[model samples]
Target: MKDTFTETVLEVRGLTTTISGKRGEFTAVENVDLTLKRGETLGLVGESGSGKSLTGLSLLRLVPKPAARIAAGSVVLDGIDLMSLTEDQMRQVRGRKISMILQDPQTSLNPSFTVGSQIAEALALHTDTPRKSLRDKAIEMLRRVRVAAPEHRVDAYPHQMSGGMRQRAVGAVAISCAPDVIIADEPTTSLDVTVQAQYIRLLQELQRESGMGIIFITHDFGIVAKVCHRLAVMYAGQIVETGPVAQIFDQPLHPYTRALLSSVPKLHGQIGRLPSIEGTPPPLWDRPRGCKFSPRCPLADHRCRNEEPPTVDSPAPDGSEHWARCWKPEAI
Candidate 1:
């Protein structure tokens, strides 16, 4: 078996997803490229409708049918191209190798079945463990996620558990088979502040123990700071900036990235009021002709409006390097 700890478990290159609308095909995600190393966390952050969640779903080939399609690009997980897989072939890889914890656990979990039964079923489907050993494995997985009294809670239904518990249970199922990569899509959205912190810490612990690469999808910069080693900022279906967490936060280059950081309310700073990014995000259907963010960007010039910029390597404050896609990235 390949040592997943040292390998690039997932590589997503030029991923683009499109949906058929009443008028015509609209691009949901465009030219997204991401790579997740084993046992590392890559935080994907963006505003609503910025294609963060859609990109996460596309990684597992789980985009909704008929309307949504992976229009272009390759999703390579462990050297296997997900786009090229048949339904049956993809099934074997989905939960066992690359699992996803969805945004809402209440809707994702089965209302009729007990949480333990659901988790056991996942294990049985993905692994060759005997029926007698499945419950123990389920309980073990639950305990690993820091669920107290796992044996008792295992028999409880989704409704019996609190929102945090339900989310943890959903996580239990996703990581039950010890997947090589876990795509957590807004896992903390339904939890309270304290519980959200605990859940994130638990995920970090689990990632450390299992050596699983994590792709954390969230809109909150606070959460990104807490869990992510590196960050990717998406805008209008494309990545505008990517760098280490410290670099991206301290010395942002892209206009959109700078605007986002400036908008964040800081505790120490005495800037009268928080800086807000001007204008709303561009609609996917009515995307701008050149740079997608050019219309709303403060530094936009004729070149920005007429020509798309290429992503260029840049130096960070700490001597590290990152890339920003802009015609005129700000000097830090």
Candidate 2:
């Protein structure tokens, strides 16, 4: 089947996450809106603590309790509001229709269960296959992920596998049920470059075959260029710029996005000193009154410091739409 689907699979509107700390209530994610069309890859690029991971977690309703809560907003998947679903109903959606591959595969995988058993458990929950068929299917999944000697590796525990192997194992389990959407949060973090490349290729191939909508979270703009069809640059807790990958690389709109792209290291020529965005991101509790990035933005004016920018529509050269939230967006 063609990967591209006309239907929209996921829609996040004005999604916000607030937590009550010992000090006071603070918003980790604020007024963030994103959408994922069926079978499309939306790369979410942001620095640490920018709430990219939190946003992904919120999509699955897996945010930690007590400390975290969806303060306000709606998460709709396939026309169903995920925020309104019961715990059991959400669980049914997770690992089956909507799955996630956490940042650290080594920590995410169970140390006690064999790789095969873990994958089988995920399959069993979502499928009606019998015991024997389930085991066979698990092995097939391992093979599909290109795990060498899948039959032998299936019985091996997570600790028995290498870092790359464990990640592949996680991928196998995540895709075993052929989810409609897969949110991979830094899936290649800390891995060797070669391994990261292979993992990314695996994911792309699988996504292409399964027609899965992907939300790939990463800090690397280069990685985003390689895999994502479209890109969303996040700063503080909101998407500042969103557009096609080519447009984002060629003509970035938001100042933060431009700064992020400028920071990527090149292989040749006199490597110019990477231009760093001055000033640190504000603490959630200490967010500015207007634009959160105004302190670091070179284009910031009085209005930028006093009023938040609205998302303005801008079309890319390829006819793909781009939107940026900035009072002084870069001119075309």
Candidate 3:
């Protein structure tokens, strides 16, 4: 028997998504690879336009249609290939086998409907719970997320709830079906620090109880450190580095990863101005010839600028293989 702690819940390989418009088609997600284990939280961190959000959407086959589509790669969830499923089958998979907690509760929750009705809608779509009992189940879910006076709040509309409460309601919707995996796409972006910490703790408690794997997408390294066990750094739609969180935090191999870590403000030392990475990520259509980050990387040389770096495997202190895409990871 495989160890439960190490059991793979989701595996993605060479996952590429394309976006189409009047500007034509461009790769928005390129050859991205990820693995999530049972009960583990994997942080997907990068700047805006780094494809962190799109990667999560693509994993669930929820990429906006007509405008963007998944052109390549495979997403295997619990040994089932999601790419092979038909639209109807995929609908069944969503909210049942897997779920997503989008970043904004305001957008996620319907202002027209009571929070209970929205949660009941999810339960109805995915489960066999009788119609009469869905409200009870919804209330139970609200309680699970630690909502105050869940019974009263359950009947309130989205606009009536606090930002944190609304986010918790969104979480209740996501976990209503007991999915094997949950993709939380910057779920704490709108909340205050206290509320964000509470939300993280709530997610941790839920994961502990359900043993569900989570792909936590965020731009905040502090939140990543608090919640994620592994880390994947994205750049220009591609994953540049991935490994155990502590190992990567201590010894980041990719230049972009190092630069990102360097920019984070420190608490222990004398307060000083934060270091900033120069230049923004390139547009998808205008990505550089070799390494996408080479243009901005201080360590880039002729080799890095002229040739694409292959993903290299380095031994991590935690006995896991740390993967980095760079010509000279040692130079950093």
Candidate 4:
């Protein structure tokens, strides 16, 4: 309930991450820029391979090394330049100042350790809690995240819990440090519809309690609508559009954004063949000459095909700016 319009928690500029493969080097996350304010949620939505996950990892400097590297960018967290930090310094920042909730709790959680031990480990790494008090702090975290019977569940290993419970355990670890920001990359992917809804609400409640910023990466527009205050639509490693959630949903300026929204099933519309975006996304190495989405865009022209469009500001009726990377935003 506190004001969400507080100080900026994270700011990323021109974040470019590249991967070197047998095929050659290609940018997995290119020229990305984003900002997150305290208590606000920013949705990073796009189709598979749009580099949403890569972007999150790059923010933390966790991109796999040798094969993948952050080629360029500045990641400033709470006024500290993460890029300038030494490896040892960055380690202190990773779980203490920022944390990530990856999809698939089965993979994220350590099956060998009790859920409470995992949470306690994070607390030990980030805080100076007494050794004997770690268990109690861990139990408190489990209760805070809504794990059932925190005292009993604390001793349960990941495999002993349900999928939803495991995911909550992962959340408990992420929030145990009370980090300034959290990057949730499709964290609800393994849960059922009802469990997914519960998980989303749990995140909202946690955000309200801590006023921490969140970068939620997912492909589901419904999740974005429910949890995010703003959105950034990515395509082929580039951000195609970004603005307030309601403005972009009601009046999407980018063709790709419109295409993505149209693909979502409507509950009220007359039932018929569901709309689908024709053609597949271009591969990273062989991206098109101009606009990346030009090949499948109905509004594509010669200019669109030959020249990459710059991100331009398209002001909404309320005077807030909606940015889009398109040459023909007026066509919408």
Candidate 5:
């Protein structure tokens, strides 16, 4: 087996997802590219419909079949290509080599099953642990996530747990197999401020312990700041900008990236109403020919409308480079 401890855990290129409907096929994600290393966190951030969650689905081969399909992509985890796996092969990959924590635990967890059984089932499916020890293993995993009273909580059904407890349980299930990569899709959406902090810290602790790569998908910049080591900003199903977390916060290059950071409510001081980005995201089916963000960009001009901007490099102080898809980033 190859060593995953210090290797690039996940690499994706030319990833595109197509949605088929009466209105014709729409490209949900287009030529999106990113990389995640073991023990690192890469935030996949964008407004709703910007293809954040769809990219996660495409990675897991869990896109709603018939209506949507992975048109093209190369998803290499460690040395294996996930896109080329058969359904049976992919089944072994999901929740074993890679796992996902969805946005809502209420829906992801089965109402009928006890929390411990579901976790034990995932563990049994992936490992050679004996039947009697499955329950103990499940509870141990729960302890790793800092779940309270794991032994007692193990028998509780989904409805019996509070929102925060259910979210933690879902996380325990996701990490049960100790997969190399974890795709957490808005895992804290249902959580309040305090619980959200605890969850974020717990994830960090887990990553430190397991050296797993994390692809954290969310629209919240606040969460991005808390958990992400690096960030990939998506717009119109494409990564418009990416860089070290601090650099993106201080020197956002793409107009869309800048606008997004600007829209975050200022905590240091007061301002008369928060600023908002103008214009809705263009319909995916009828996206503009050139820069998809041009319609909402204040600096978008004829060139932005007529010609697609290539990715420009912006090196950071930390020796890592930043990239932005824009024609005139300095103008922003």
Candidate 6:
């Protein structure tokens, strides 16, 4: 069956994260707004440096200190304004209310701590479980992620596990508290194809069990196709288009969105080389005056260059979703 999403679990508005250096302030993510419903997955797709990862960090108020910060935005999680919370309150919300599965486990996991200790620590921090039962809970969490020999493996340090096992261990920790939402930042990036597929199914199973919302961040359209209920395509730090996954894949409105979908590698039958987007992304510091994608957009005109394109929100026939920031949606 298709997604049966109902209630909105997360709503973001005007979310911007910026970094400062001698050259001046550069916006890593600008005025980004997105919604994720309970029991639904939203795919955040774009090339590296498109601010996808930064946007995820900003939602959790984890943007690196001093160098980068969430300059402006409202992050509302289940009617509560996350942006308005105090540091202590936000800390409470981080692993308990909202969790994150980072891109890499080798760097994310502390080598000194045993896998069991790390997972138990997360449960201890969030729940009132007695210290004695924490170890059992940690083992159960590992089992939930389909880790083999959880009882014994939990005692091993991260370095002792395979890459896939470490990733699964990280997943165990991320979902340990049964968070309302999980921000998966390309969690499958480093895994081989087989392991990647397994991890994806593991995540889907966990989401089904908990009805948690997920923001799956990746540039792989195939992953988007496999998991996402909706799509949000970013380019050079801005979301150029967003809509239901089927609608956007079938009929992308923005040129950049179309290009991205077109570049997805086909697998069914024999085909020539895969298509790719032309030109590199605009440098953040020297970004063009108007639409950041205008320079490479084929349909771009004088208006597109000099003015920010207005968003055209055309609702789908199924009442699913549709929206595009382009001067010429009719052209598509």
Q: Cα lDDT of all candidates, in order?
A: 0.88, 0.88, 0.92, 0.92, 0.90, 0.92
Identify the runs in model 3 with alpha carbons over 4 angstroms from their true place.
1-4
Please list the Cα RMSD from the true structure of every candidate, rounded to 1 decimal place.
2.9, 1.8, 2.0, 1.5, 2.9, 1.2
Which pairs of residues have clashing backbones in candidate 1? none
Q: Which pairs in model 5 have colliding backbones?
A: none
Candidate 4 per-residue lDDT over residues 191-272, each given as its tens digit: 9999999999999999999999999999999999999988999999999999889889998989999989988998997699
TM accuracy, model 3: 0.97
Report how far off residue 130 is in candidate 4 (Å).
0.8
Tens digits of per-residue lDDT for model 6, 1-332? 27667899999999999999777999989999999999899999999989999999999999988899888989999899999999999999999989999999777789999999999998999899999999999999999999999999989999999999999999999999999999999999999999999999999999999999999999999899999999999988999899999888888899998888777777784588877888999977678878889899888899889999999987777887689988988534
Error of 3 at 250 (Å): 0.8
Task: Write model 2 residue lDDT over 206-274, tens digit each, in one string.
Answer: 987888899999998778988898888888888899988887788888888988888788777356677
TM-score of 2: 0.96
- Model 4 scores a TM of 0.97
Give the alpha carbon lDDT tens digit for every residue of 7-99 in model 1: 788888999999887859999899998888888888999999999999998998888888899999998888889899999999999899999
Error of 3 at 137 (Å): 0.3
Per-prediction TM-score to the true structure, in the order listed: 0.95, 0.96, 0.97, 0.97, 0.96, 0.97
Q: Candidate 5: misplaced stretches above 4 Å?
A: 1-6
Over 4 Å off, model 4: 1-4
Give residue 141's lDDT in candidate 4 (0 to 100): 97
- Least accurate stretch of 10 residues (summed lDDT) in model 3? 1-10
**Model 6 residue 148 lDDT?**
99
Candidates 2 and 3, the one with greater TM-score: 3
Q: What stretches of model 6 exceed 4 Å from their correct place?
A: 330-332
